[model samples]
Target: MTRAPNEDAIWVALVDDYDVVVKGVATMLDPYRDRVLVAELDTDRPVKDDVDIALYDSFAQPESDQEQIKVLLANPRARKVVVYTWNFHPELVEAARALGTHGYLSKALPARDLVAALEAVHAGEIVFSDPPSRMRTPTSQDWPGRQEGLTDREAEILALITQGKNNADICEVTYLAPNTVKSYVRNLYRKIEVDSRTQAVVWGVRHGFLPDHHRIDHWRGGP
Candidate 1:
């Protein structure tokens, strides 16, 4: 299904601090200069500004993984982000879905596959499945396994934080002391790679399954 390169160029932001990866990808994609714009970004890049697509390494911890994803998805210009990695984790895919990722593929995949994945996502299909590898199937049964790898419980606590819950309400609901909850929320923001409830809400809506300010989950009679 290799069609003519759609008339518009796809702007891609390569968000990695490593020089070799950035340089290698850039060199590999040199032929498509007119079609691809590659910029190696760290935290310093204004993530919310502009981008059309992204190729990132999300084969890591949920905390770090989501952090990198937020940087790309937050961009108004970015419509899709394809995570390139050697090892694909099931939980990472789940988080990416919540975060609105376009798709992800293996770094070991052929170069043609990578380009095809990029084009596929850019063309409006969000490919979320990872082929069988060392990773286990992404069943709901794997939920506990997914949550277990967190560097801290604070981030897990943040997952339960609804938009309307205040510090006092959270203390009562979570059964944590008020000061502890506040500290946890602060740390959670740093952990899940978001700043405010709004960002977290957006993050949840895109990659995780959660209700928005509209409280649609409540309306659905969900617990």
Candidate 2:
């Protein structure tokens, strides 16, 4: 059951380069607003609020290897930086942990479980989700190309392609094996009906595959 709103609700800021991806996470946590208030949604910008948690959504963004997490961790306004991602390779998790990330959550979690995890992290506990099952259950999360029938992973690959990343760059950023990256590229190409990398990049550009370069401070009422 939905609880009454608490004045001390865990203030959360959803951070990602894609507005749709961040909004999707906000919508997933909407039913639990009383427990977790999504105060800000930042796209390609540093968070400006004094929030309890900065949930960094890794949809199409660089993973543990990149500097985004470090940037979030450096923000004094954000009390804690947690990575909300689909990739859970041990190396990536260790990298994030080494970078002082407070929590590492999975995209496979249901809304309620996700809220609980955030609460745990707020209470000064380091949290990490179990390795997701190979056959994953569908959740109410969103990605850039979902409307066009691309899974979140496929959408991520396409987004990187749109950013002018070659297969090698994608593999490095995503931590996927060379073969796995090639396979994802192949599948996404078929889904988008493109015959070449150039065609795929063109389709991605036309279909909102690029990162958003704005911020939405919901409480203040505009970007």
Candidate 3:
């Protein structure tokens, strides 16, 4: 049966290729079970159960302008789709809006604020978090290289590199300046103790940098 928002908690599905990323968000929202119930955590599979929102996490995945947004929006099970991302470039935001996304939220938002935003979106309001002044590492979230002293941004860059994205590709996808992308690459290389791209890719392969290529079925429990 299709579920609708009522007096109960808003049902949300966390979408991302990395289990750690979506699980982090789920854990952040766990305390707010009365206001938000994370009904699904979709790694690569389509969300099965009907949900009020599909929170698309942009960790190691394509930005908002890509086809994934359309895929999420097309799923009838997801009543709304929201881009949960750190990149809030104007073009990216506009593109998502043009594509009919219900919201574009920043990763910097605290768990409480995130829940509030989700509630607002569920109430039929098109919401967008103010462009963050700076991309501070969200302490509550998790990424691939967090254990090795790599910040979320650094870990994202390394994941892209592992996926065979060059510096130019990185800049295009991340909306970062050429020099900035180079700097991130260098920093991640240093943190991972690799001196070259090939070495970094090898290390990334060994240490969970590659994305989980398949969707997780029966996540938490079978739908």
> What are the models' TM-scores?
0.49, 0.87, 0.89
Off by over 4 Å in 1: 1-7, 41-49, 59-63, 132-223
Q: For candidate 3, lDDT tens digit of each residue in 61-137?
A: 66433677777787677789999998988888899999999999999998899999999999999999999998775
Tens digit of lDDT per residue, candidate 2, span 78-128? 789899888887888888899999899888888899899999999999998
Q: Estimate the Cα RMSD of every predicted model relative to the unseen true structure.
A: 14.3, 4.5, 3.8
Clashing pairs in 2: none
* Pairs clashing within candidate 1: 51-77, 97-207, 98-206, 98-207, 98-208, 99-206, 99-207
TM-score of 2: 0.87
Pick out the ten consecutive residues of candidate 3 with the lowest summed lDDT.
Answer: 214-223
Model 1 TM-score (2 dp) = 0.49
Candidate 2 wrongly placed segments (more than 4 Å): 1-5, 42-48, 63-66, 135-138, 213-223
Q: lDDT, candidate 1, residue 100?
A: 79
